[model samples]
Target: MIPSNKPFFDDTEIEYATASIQSGNIAGDGPFGRKLENKLSDYLECKHALLVNSCTSAIEISLFALGIGPGDEVICPSFGFVSVANAILQCGAKPVFAEIDYETMNLDPAHTEKQITTRTRAIILIHYAGMSCDLVSFSELKEKHGLYLIEDAAQALGSKLQGKALGTFGDSGCFSLHETKNLTCGEGGIFVTNDDNIAQQAEIIREKGTNRSSFLRREVQKYTWVGRGSSYILSDILAAVALAQFEKIEPILSSRTKIAEFYQNAFAPYNYITPPTIPDGCKPNWHLFALRINKLHRDIFLEKLKSKGIGASFHFVPLHSAPYSKTKLKGGNVSLPVTDRVASELIRIPIYPQLSNAEKESVVSSMEEVAEELGLE
Candidate 1:
């Protein structure tokens, strides 16, 4: 049976973790964590990178650093994880749900304009399935509206757009290194930005609002209270694990892309399904190989795939459908028709870097069989 996703880690990570433990410095921002942050900066072309315990923490801390609080409105797509909205709520800010573009599954600049008000302070753009949103086009809207852009690049560690990394597009961007993400450290995330002041503030916020990180950097001898903050940092052991995975990032990316291409090629012939597409200016990391099946038969299709041991599944249920968003935010308008439709029909095939060529072929064949059985082909 093909699994949905798996980290492509090997012996390199084991040695790194073991050595870090042996050294007795199994704390935050240790050798491996510092090195990992430096390497991520070089890779993402950002001036500062702060490792955290999760992408949610990264975005939350970013909001805290930006001084966002109650009464502030942050425009974000409603079709993604509830965590996006949750982060804003945690900051005591309102998350104004912006519609998404069906073709790219990213925030729709046109719709985003309709939702903005004087309270709007930021625009959070998610790179769905590791595909970069049209940040350049957002450049105009962003500048005109004076709205800060925050890229939710959790699934887009290796993806780029116009030669720049996805997460580096806005004032600050967040990436997840969760167990499910391409670069896994079991569960971790990072925040990257070019602004020195924001970086310093973020460091303070991530360390329980203290000067510990600065002290660890040897910028000072002792650390103490400096600002408002919380503990949002990644442990050294997790950094060691991520460093080993980072070493093989190239191979993992290549393999995932290959599998994505195979799924696209195999499913291209079907008239009833639509495969994922990459806009000309964007390059996707192919974190998940998703397609649209006939919504009417979507459940049966999921059942068939699972029965065949294919491990196929679906992504986020439309945030509007959730109880909180439905009651508090959706306003009972049921306005996001496309988001509902897409959520119903979407299917995620197995996309781990370790997925064998034969397993990929099997998934393709089984998918075609289910489609044919339901007269979808």
Candidate 2:
């Protein structure tokens, strides 16, 4: 069977990681870590970025740094990886689930406004499938409500909205270098922002809630516990691997884009299944190739594709329907029809950087055969 995803790397990645071991700085704070941070800051155009152990840690630190805790509510989309909602819940805050536009698969700002209560402190906007959300509308909502907007750019490495980088639009943004993301460190993440105050607090937050970063930089002689925090820093070896990936990001992004275009061109009979659409002024990373097929036969379609040795699968499950959110975050069976419908029907195809042209042809042929057999073509 064709693999669903494959991480791309060269001998460069191996050498960098090995060098970190030889340098005797396998710890969180090391030269390799600093090198990755500098490159990430430059690429994302953020002032101060801190590498972390995972994207979850990045979001958790951003929440704590922004002082979102008990009695706080963070607005977010109902449809996404549960981690985005998990971060707010981790901070002892409520995750107010908002609906999404099925086409864009992101938070609907209009619905978000209705969901926000007086206790709202922040908004976590995820760029679903690396397609930049309606940031202009989301930003307007943030300003009007005086709420802090946090960008969950986990899937959006090179994505931008109206020329501005996706992650930089909010008070704080988090990026994942997970094996599944556009960028990879195997398992790593980054926290980014231009704001000095938040950035300073984040360093403290990621370092076991101390001023250790300042001490490490020799700005302070001694460091002590200053607030509530945990060890969220990434290891130097991981940073080394991540840095090499960042350096060759252009090629990786181009390859992913090329595959996406190929799929678009081949799937031009778009009515059979809906494909992702990039709105005006947005440049998506094409992290995922999600198609909306007939909702009733979604499973049948998936099984057929799987039988054909195509690594096609379904997209995320709606968080609202999940046991945790149904019981805690939502506190009620709040029926989100759009999220429910999309979750049941969205099919994901292979779009990894190394996906070959021959594989693409085979995938398309298999899908067309499936559609014909189902009498839907």
RMSD of each: 1.2, 1.2
Candidate 1 wrongly placed segments (more than 4 Å): 329-334
- Clash pairs, candidate 1, are none
For each candidate, give its TM-score against the true structure. 0.98, 0.98
Residues 217-329, candidate 1: write the lDDT tens digits.
78999999999998899999989998898888888889888888888888888898888879677777888887887788888989999999988898778776778776777
Model 2 TM-score, all chains together: 0.98
TM-score, prediction 1: 0.98
**What local distance difference test score does each model get?**
0.87, 0.87
